[model samples]
Target: ELAPRGYIAEGWLNAVRTREDAYPTGLAMPAANIAIPHTDPGFVAKPYIAVVKPAAPVTFNAMAGMGAPVPAQIVINLGIAEPGGQVEALQALMNIFMDTDAAADVLGQTTPQGMVDAIRRHF
Candidate 1:
């Protein structure tokens, strides 16, 4: 999430991939298309969520240890701004993604504003 991509989903995936060698974006979720690209807070400056709706799907190293070459289309770039300011919020998201129902709820949300609203509520 160093360089942000507003709506280019593929480019956004690349940005996330650059940090995390394995693309955490397109994991095998119940949903059709999805991605979760995150890295250590060191690479980020201001913490904010960047959403990218790419024109086409992009491939990423899905299984890091497995060496399986799976790819994902959509990308969610996560940057931690003021890491100390958002620990609880970030952990909430981590927990959300861990829970199938919660992840579904997050993915079900539409529009950047929707995501923003959820983030704000967490804060």
Candidate 2:
């Protein structure tokens, strides 16, 4: 979705996959398990946050759990254009995830637009 809008480079998906393999981003939140996958800024054409809720849970490695598996129902892909921005964005996302009400609000949305709206409302 982001590529057509010029938010990322041609190999951004591959790059993010490779990076996720090396440094996992899955977090086990109170409301839901989630993954925040991203790559280096070079692959990003513009900063964008892509939120996805798969039809079924997707397995991801826990960020700080040394390869522990996390079945993530929500995935937030971050396309950040600057290194500093990545940290800031992650911090903000963490805040939301840590808030049960906020996380539940985001997870409660059924549609893409509704999800985006929920995120924006909490963010």
Candidate 3:
């Protein structure tokens, strides 16, 4: 969807799917399980962050190892301009990720507006 909207490059979605196969994105937080799926910055048309919540939990291999699987309730997709931007964005994300209480509040967001509001508050 974002690809068509020019939010990301032509192969961005496929790139992320492929990269995720080799390097999983699952994060097992105390408050809620989350996944950060991102691809190379070259595939980004513009910098953006997208939040998604699945109707049912999805299992993804944990960042720790192949043997560990994390059930993700929410997924955060990041499209950063480059490596430097990726680092900066990730550092900001770490602040939210490390705090289970804050992360839970983000996960609790139901509507799109609510999610947008939550991100605004966090960032």
Candidate 4:
């Protein structure tokens, strides 16, 4: 979605995948397991955040669990063009993850606008 909009460079997906392999972004929370995949600013043309809720859970390596697996249903893809932008975004996501109600709200959305609304409420 972001590619056609020119928010990401040609190698953005590959770069994110490579980064994910090295430093996992999965977080196991009370409401649901989630993953925030991202790469360096060089692969981004514009800063943007994309959210995906898969029909089935996807496996991801936990960020701080020493390669432990997390079955994530919510995947957040980040395209950040600034050096420290990811930190702020991650902090906001962490806030939502820490609150079970907020995380549940985000996970309950079925539409794109609904998801945006849910995230905006806690973001």
Candidate 5:
């Protein structure tokens, strides 16, 4: 089944599971930070893309220990919008995080725009 807007169901579920993988792409929301890393539905070879977000700073083991969280000022919503665009989106995001200095700056920014600007530089 699908939504009136063409939102696929299977892909959504898979996205949730794929997001669960921490080592590859895991984050823990800091005490005053919040962030959501989600992907498109199409990224999913089976269902959805590998996307996940943490409600609170989750202590992910496989990834490391404490993954980053969402920006407290931003509303981090999760879901697969498209059918096959997740892979690229996620890859792009991963590439951005590859920079240790950049990721540090992004996760430590004080304001929302600062955070966004940090992300914009990635793409």
Candidate 6:
């Protein structure tokens, strides 16, 4: 649905899933464990970030050394067409990931709009 909505290429979702299955994007942060799933620029139609908070955490391999399995509560689907922007976005997200207080605050939001607003304020 997100891909067909013009946020990414037709096969972007499959690409992301495949990439994640192979490389894993999970990060074990001080605040909370998270996974930043993304695909190459060729699979992107426009730059967008989808914030998904599942009712239950999903296990993913950690991005760090040894690739430990981590249960992530927050999954950010990064849809960036430009490499430069992807780097910048990841850097910003890393900051939020490390901030337990900020991450908790963002997760406390009860609505989608509130989550977006929280992200904007934090970033």
Best by TM-score, which number? 4
- The residue-level lDDT of candidate 3 at 42 comes to 91
Error of 1 at 10 (Å): 21
User: Estimated TM-score per prediction?
Assistant: 0.49, 0.93, 0.88, 0.94, 0.45, 0.91
Better of 5 and 6 by TM-score: 6
1-123 in candidate 5: lDDT tens per residue?
233444444555566456655433333332223334454545333332222233345433322444443223222323545566555655555555556665676666666577677667764
For each candidate, the alpha-carbon lDDT, in order, equals 0.53, 0.89, 0.81, 0.90, 0.45, 0.84
lDDT of 3 by residue, 1-123 (tens): 686788997778789999788888887776678788899989998888988889988888887474579888888888987776766776677677678777877888889889878877886
- Evaluation by lDDT, superior candidate among 1 and 6: 6
Which ten contiguous residues of candidate 3 have the minimum total lDDT? Answer: 86-95
User: Per-residue error at 89 for model 6, in Å?
Assistant: 0.9
Q: Which one wins by TM-score: 1 or 4?
A: 4
In model 4, where do residues sit more than 4 Å from their true spots?
65-67
The best candidate by lDDT is 4
How well does candidate 1 score on lDDT at residue 17?
Answer: 57
Q: Where in model 2 is the C-alpha error above 4 Å?
A: none
TM-score pick, better of 2 and 4: 4
Compose the digit string of candidate 6's lDDT tens values, residues 10-117: 787789888888878888888988889898888988878889888999888877445688898888888888865677888898899799888998778888888888
The deviation in Å at residue 73 for candidate 5 is 15
- Tens digit of per-residue lDDT, candidate 2, span 40-93: 999999889999999998999999665569899899998889886888888888
Span of ten consecutive residues with least summed lDDT in model 1: 1-10
lDDT of 2: 0.89
